[model samples]
Target: MNRGKLNGVAGTTGALCAVVLLGNVMAPDAHAQNSVTLYGVVDAGVTYTSNAGGSNQYALTSGNMGANRWGLRGSEDLGGGLSTIFTLESGFTIANGKFGQNGTFFGRQAFVGLSGSWGAVTLGRQYASSSQFVGPLASGSSWAAPGMGYGTHPADLDNLNSTNRINNSIKFASANYNGLTFGGLYSLGGVAGDFSRNQIYSLAIGYTQGPVKLALGYLNVRNPNYSFWGNKANDSTTASNITSPVIAGYASANTQQVIAAGTSYAIGSATLGAVYSNVRFSGLGATPVAGLSSTAAAYRGSATFNNGELNAKYQVSPALLVGAAFDYMKGNGAGQGGVIYRQFNLGADYFLSKATDFYAVAVFQNASGVDSRGVRAVAAITGATPSTSSSQTVVTAGIRHLF
Candidate 1:
């Protein structure tokens, strides 16, 4: 999903080769009982959007229903209820066999850690705490991989869609204690002489008893433009599917913070969920150009976004599942006084087999007030281009397979 140059030479064949090599190298040990697993999902679809850059368009896309990815997970038993674990995952677009996540081989995740009765401690690039605990309860994450953006709060300002990952991080996830669990994370900016340059910290707590689930999470970032993903300022290579006019120009912020909570309940064959999130961007700035006053020039001073979502899903049969979600976003700040966004998402999936399915989804969104560009706030779906008007619609049909 990154905007980096696609390595045309390393196509699907190369990926397959890498998978095979890794599997062979990590073959399970019979005596030790240590194990390694290889898994993946492939999804593709045809899509139509009511508006994209002032034109109605139809196209072939990857990850509409789920992200296309393959990964390796392994664990080594070290006796006494202790174990060492690791995971390496990568995402790619099947349409042109291009790597995703800014073209990193293990962009989705890359981590190694130790686990015991108490908890697990992991090190490496990984999901932020908010992304780990809160995102799961969001309607956007219910569908599957490459989660639908329509269910994400406008522009994903709250990190509910796993938009960014942290680097140089240490994470701790406590063992579930009678359906209660908690975790935390800290990422070092790795900038010597300035410990606070691009640091990040997060905490999350959750509980699940029976069919009820709840979670509360918080995340704070220093220099979001550089800390979120350890990317350089104004770097075009890190772009993903999240290019929305709603947040495109506000990335250069001195700090960003988010607090979110979610809960879900199951009744009969249906599950209902609700989520709320508040996000603040303080001291936003424009990229430094000629003779700019630090990186805070063009400062928007500060901004805030509040979002709410209600969603539900029903299982009508062994092979069919249907769901719907409604999301609302309210934005206010020095530059955005009345910006608001409303979105609706509906989807269905028909299971062809345990590891394969056919799916269809549709989304409609409307925007009101003005945007950062001082233009009318136009509808901008997560994975599609922004509309020239106040409303936009997107529909897609796709197939997915797992291995």
Candidate 2:
């Protein structure tokens, strides 16, 4: 062949190779560029707990490892480094499909966001700041069953749990910078023309590099306890003033502010984590204990407190994992009412494959003060019939499959 023809062929071949490589990166999902995915999990099993206290407790249950759920999520790319993303997830009872959270669709999370270099802005129902900060440290990797982190903070102080989720909200998450990232959210009471009368504000900060992770966050919600925890904050009328009490030292009223920090370090087969959170709940941050008139008590209920926890997990083999966790919280005054809680859970999982697994989870708890104090696990939600109120010694073995 002539030298000119050889040179022309080589140039064309080089250009083709570069074009193909760049196309793979820029158009990797070209086939499904504007497609939605339908995914879900179905988990159900029988659960038994000791110390029923005259209550009939053993029974078959559902929504164990995976909250029998179905969700649709998608992303659309716009020119110039912009994209729109959304996730709509809902939970249902596998035993009956009665829908979790009292049959509300999208009870887990429902949000849409626009993402780019500046960060992402999301709107709709979601998770609260405290849950976003502490869940990973506590309930994130747990797969035993219920009785994990459903109100185990020294009288549910930090609300590290309660298996809580947020609603009627919008959030902004910042892009990563040198292992540091930040996020903030606000949930409007959704009252017409009356904003800030009953709203929630939350902020979270996190840092991650390699095997180390750290996070700290803050949340302020007016009438928050009833607003998020009791799910009553959404029903208040403008005419009805928030008459919750404020007690500094322990669990009491409806106003809540929580500041939490947590860190985790990974070393080979093990991961260690510890978290500390200062949760203060007061009625308008008021603390007037001496000679209060009856009129004041009629208008308020008050309490404040702090709680902390330490948790860890280990991977024993490719298909097996073992974990143990503990937490302790203390209150200052009558709110203590001996209201201290501690949980000890040891559990393991055996993977059948990438999508199927079996697990045996055991949890033990002690409530020292109130009759109902230690009945709930700090990292697991103990779900059962309302008739079974006695709380202690939860043992569950279940199978989970994902698709």
Candidate 3:
């Protein structure tokens, strides 16, 4: 009798397992298609700067040309030409293995949305349309490569090099139509009782046909200091987060606007590029923000900066490239007493493999006239300390690997 009971129990268990397996096989969502990918870049270099804060210096730097980062990208096909997608990218400093972008874990980007044949719409922290669409035509983000930051226009005033990202943003990018594309972005301020406070909006259009490419972009920000420069939680109107001496005095401006255009043409083994940008800081306060440069008190109106750049690159061989660029910037109004910056950059890269490269770059800049601080202008390079004088030079050699 005991043996009979054991057999009956075994049969009952087998029947129940079969039913569960069949249920799983019949489920409609069980076969849904999805994929996830892990990607990253590592970069490091040694750098030398002439006239940094009154002293020449040499140091190990991270992200000489491009940022060090790792990320996860995922997509799920929902069928009918529509898909769900997401990305979570993190930035870090390789030198000390510290988180970048103010120690935020996913500081580079974190977004999710859907894509179809028409285009994509995403919501999260992301680059503005200007940087996404037009930045590539600038040498800082193009052939210059591994030392792009060092080649940026003075202080990256025009943001063509993507110095900042917008938080709480909604973005739209259209599908390419015969080599033409367009996009836009809007960032909510998230401030209580004020819809426009610290808000930002941007639009960009681009075209590429054969050897020719062109782009135009526009960006507008309210409470620029709090919106674009400070952390997302920053809400103090009487304080400032504008650290770059290049435009620190405009921290009290109520709004900021930018317009930029760029083009590139390829001829045989050579490519030529040009970019122009205009930046404006309007509705300046009569008094400077606390802990800010005293020069902010000198302005009660608007300040404007115009920047122009030209660059060229040549493919020396299948594995080597060389490039050069020239940039000029002028700032006026808002009691700046006129300021000017002229810069030059030279760079070269050699590919060791499809995923690794070595590069070298040199940049020089000179400044003249009065700056936003109401004092003699000083040379300032993006990602470097300000010079104590009117001139500065930086050189770097680096290696980059992608995975």
Model 2: per-residue Cα lDDT over 57-161, one tens digit each: 676667665567766566778758888877787877877768676556777778988989889898987777656655567632354454323223433345555
Better of 2 and 3 by lDDT: 3
RMSD for each of the candidates = 5.6, 11.7, 10.2
Using lDDT as the measure, the top candidate is 3
List the candidate numbers ranked by TM-score, top first.
Answer: 3, 1, 2
Alpha-carbon lDDT, every model: 0.79, 0.60, 0.83
| Candidate 1 deviant stretches above 4 angstroms | 1-33, 229-242, 286-297
Write down the lDDT that model 1 would get: 0.79
Q: Among these predicted structures, which one has the highest TM-score?
A: 3
Candidate 1 lDDT tens digits, 1-403: 2111122223547756676567557864523537656677888999899999999999998877778887767777999999988888888888999887768778888999999999999999899887788898877776732444655677777887887888889999999999999999999988889898778999999999999999999999887765674352234433322247786556666788999999999999999999999998887763232322232246578878889999998998999999888889988775564899999888899998888899988888999997654467899887788899999998989898887
Where does the lowest 10-residue lDDT sum fall in candidate 3?
1-10
- Compared with the true structure, the alpha-carbon lDDT of candidate 3 equals 0.83
State the RMSD for candidate 2: 11.7
